[model samples]
Target: MLEKLLPIQKNLNEQPQNPDSSPEESNTSPNLLESFKDDFFESYSFVNKATLILKLFILILPGVFFFMLALNDALDRKIMALEDDKNVLTDELFVYPDVQAIHTSVVLREQILKQVNEKEHYAPAMLDSIIKSLPEGVSIKNEMVQGKTASLILLSPGPLNVASFITNVLKDDFAQEVSILSANLVMTQNIYEIELVVRYR
Candidate 1:
């Protein structure tokens, strides 16, 4: 029985194996191995990309933070400097009333000088008018000006001439007030001497 079983086993083992099955199994094993290798490489590449991104973030994050910190520091310093300047200016303004007073005085002086110049410009024209208004028998002996006031000593042939001079002076637009301070009849020269004071508006 053993001998008969051995022959049967030999025959079964010797029977022609399926030639296509070996090649197909061999091809499938290699394909599966190649697919596994490709999958492993793909996973490694993804992990490498993730690691590279993490490294880049780690590298750049501190630089960005430090840059922001430096910018903030610079702004703070600039703000502090501006505040210091403002404080200094405020302190100077607080400490110096004299400077303000001097500026005010200068402005006032300029205004006064401008007014004086304007008044002086009209003086010659006013003098011409006064001279033209005088009567033929009257002449100005002496004239003095102090600020807006005028003092005139007039020599007139008669009281009428003196009165005419006063009337003419009073009629002037620039004259605020006019007064004959004194009128004296001079017998030696047969003339009337009049002292007139005129005030300008």
Candidate 2:
């Protein structure tokens, strides 16, 4: 048996190797697959990506929890401040009327009215009363009120009678100091017009 195997091995070793044989016919396909194996592993590697995502989530979770806690604490403090303010306002409401701030507006209005009555240079009310007391057919041409002085122009049909009328008005008890500004004769209407100014004491 050893002698027969020796001859068979010697005959296998004596076979000639062909240098012109194509690599594709030999072991070409497996060599290409071996080179691409490293690239395939690099292209489809999910473990590193999964580990990176897990690390990012770990970093963000603490920040999210911290933000939530801080926001809740801030809202609690704000609510506490609002409750304190509400309690203070509720307590002040009962004692507000006795604080001397009430009735100040009424007192101020009374003071203003008193001051207006005491002032010497206010005669609009008196002038209105005087206008209402004038007799018929006695139309006033001009009426002016300034400070405490009231002036008016009296027009009548009888010419040159305005001066006498003014003199009579000055002697009346209701009339104060009177001054005749002018007495003129209008020829077209044949009337006597006189301007008189009266002062209210």
Candidate 3:
């Protein structure tokens, strides 16, 4: 066996050692540029992804703060405007011309008071005297007595008798004076109606 292996060993020793064939020698040599290309690409891809993330974070920061400030300012302005509008409306409510509830109440009270006062304006004794003095065939249409004078309208049959009666009444001591204010002659069914005004005590 030893004698048979000697020839193979001698042949192995005769083979030449190529310097570029070793793995360590190939790594140390800088001429093989394709070997490191995958590592460079992986490192560049990682760095690009990181840079993109950082830029996105920086861009979003100011936008978030600016939005918050804008919302706050809008709310402040809205609140101030509402307050001013409320104040203006409150002030205007007082001076508005159509708000007449108080004035209407006062006017109603005045009208009622005036009606009540007018009902009680006459003296009782004077009213009694005028009612007692109404004569037959000489009906008074209206009478307004004040102080010592009594003004009245007398209805008579004719103008001649009314004139004579007026003259006679004026001569009496109780009569003060006589002056006719209005006269109207109405004729119907053979009857003459005369309206005359007379002044008396």
RMSD of each: 12.4, 10.9, 17.2
Off by over 4 Å in 3: 1-42, 96-201
lDDT (tens digit, per residue) of candidate 3 on 1-201: 689988866755544355455564335334677456666547978889888998999999999999999999999999999999999998998796665887898999999999988763434544554455444455566677765556666666656655665665555555567667677655553333444344444
Q: Show the lowest summed lDDT stretch of 10 residues, model 2.
A: 22-31
- Write the residue-wise lDDT of candidate 2 on 1-201 in tens digits: 688888756744543365576554344332566444444436646667777889999999999999999999999999999999999998988777665655787788899999988867556565655565555556789888887778889887763355445555565565678787887789898777877887766
Model 2, position 174, has a per-residue lDDT of 57
By lDDT: ranked, best first: 1, 2, 3
lDDT of each: 0.80, 0.71, 0.64
Which candidate comes out best when scored by TM-score? 1
Tell me the deviation in Å of residue 176 in model 2: 3.0
Which run of 10 residues does model 3 get worst, by summed lDDT? 189-198
Which candidate should be chosen as best, given lDDT against the real structure?
1
Candidate numbers, best TM-score first, in rank order: 1, 2, 3
Each prediction's TM-score versus the true structure: 0.43, 0.42, 0.29
